[model samples]
Target chain A: AQRVTQPEKLLSVFKGAPVELKCNYSYSGSPELFWYVQYSRQRLQLLLRHISRESIKGFTADLNKGETSFHLKKPFAQEEDSAMYYCALSYSGGGADGLTFGKGTHLIIQP
Target chain B: DAGVTQSPTHLIKTRGQHVTLRCSPISGHKSVSWYQQVLGQGPQFIFQYYEKEERGRGNFPDRFSARQFPNYSSELNVNALLLGDSALYLCASSFGTASYEQYFGPGTRLTVT
Candidate 1:
């Protein structure tokens, strides 16, 4: 079974400081990973996907196949960036395809 | 154009009762997926429908069911709801079944009493 793990339940960092949201996955085949963010009382929104390799909101995530990790990183965090982050793995099996998500990590960027 | 829309922003029901939640995918999007988010937890995929057919279903039991309409809109129905079923139900839409990037709608918060 494929699974995504986000070890940190909450991470607090000062504004303008670097931020890294850790994510690791367990899958045997080629994997597609993504990071999704949810603002307070808002729906989850896709932040970035490893396939795109495009940066969004100054955040980037590189999928390391060796480490089986796709950690989200930003050089300088902003107050508005505070939100809940989830790591997702795309799973395709037996005609059933869906995303398996981590428990989620709450990020707090303090000014 | 409007984004994905979910009806009844909030709902309350009792144990053993049944409830239905509706969602309309963004225009031109043929795929709709349902997720359940427990308090303080990430959303769990429940069902995915494309072109009026069931494409995917999660580990949820048979008490949960869903269907897609010709217009691409979808509805999730829960039978014999339990208190543990309380959570925010989110609807996600993608251009196709293979489209990995999904757009999510403001979830309908279901509180089972």
Candidate 2:
């Protein structure tokens, strides 16, 4: 079974500081990875996907096949960046399947 | 365009009772998926539907069931609910199957007493 692991349950960073949310996955085949975020009282939304390779809201993640990791990164964290972040994976990468999600990390940006 | 939407934003039910949650996908989306999010935990996959047909399902018990409509909307029904069933139920929609990025709904909070 494919499983996503997000080691940190909470992460705190100062404004303008760099932030990295760790995410590692265990899947046998090529998998599609994504980062989803939920703001306070807001619905969950997609932050970015590895296949796109494009940054959203100054956040970027690179899929490392060798290490089976897809860590989210931002050079400068902003106070508004505080939210819950989830790392999700789709094992088949092709079929209409549900994503397996990590427990999520609560990101707190202190001003 | 509207994102995925769920109805009955919040609900409370007693144990052994049944409940139904509804979801409407984005205007052009054809695939819908359901998930359960417990407190302090990640969302767990429940079911996936595309083109009014069942495509995939997660490791859930038979008490959990869902169906897609011809219009692409979907409904999740849980039978004989337990206290453990209390959680936030999420609905996601996409243009295609798992190959496409899924858009999530605001989620319906269900509490089983």
DockQ of each: 0.54, 0.74
Error of 2 at A8 (Å): 0.7
lDDT of candidate 1 over A1-111, digit per residue (tens): 999999999999999999999999999998788899999987789888898899999999999999999999999999999999999988673134778899999999998
Query: Residue A56 lDDT in model 1?
Result: 97
Residues B17-111 of candidate 1 have per-residue lDDT tens digits of: 99999999988999999999999778898999989999888999999999999999999999999999999999999888763658999999999
**TM-score for chain B in model 2:** 0.97
lDDT of 2 by residue, A1-111 (tens): 899999999999999999999999999999999999999998888899999999999999999999999999999999999999999998887576788999999999999
True interface contacts reproduced by each model, as a fraction? 0.47, 0.80
TM-score of chain B of each: 0.97, 0.97
> Model 1, which residues run further than 4 Å from truth?
A93-96
In model 1, residue pairs whose N, Cα or C atoms come closer than 3 Å (at least 3 residues apart or on different chains), thus clashing, are none
How far residue B73's Cα lies from its native spot in candidate 2, in Å, is 1.2
User: Across residues B24-46, which tens digit of lDDT does each residue of candidate 2 receive?
Assistant: 99998999999999999999999
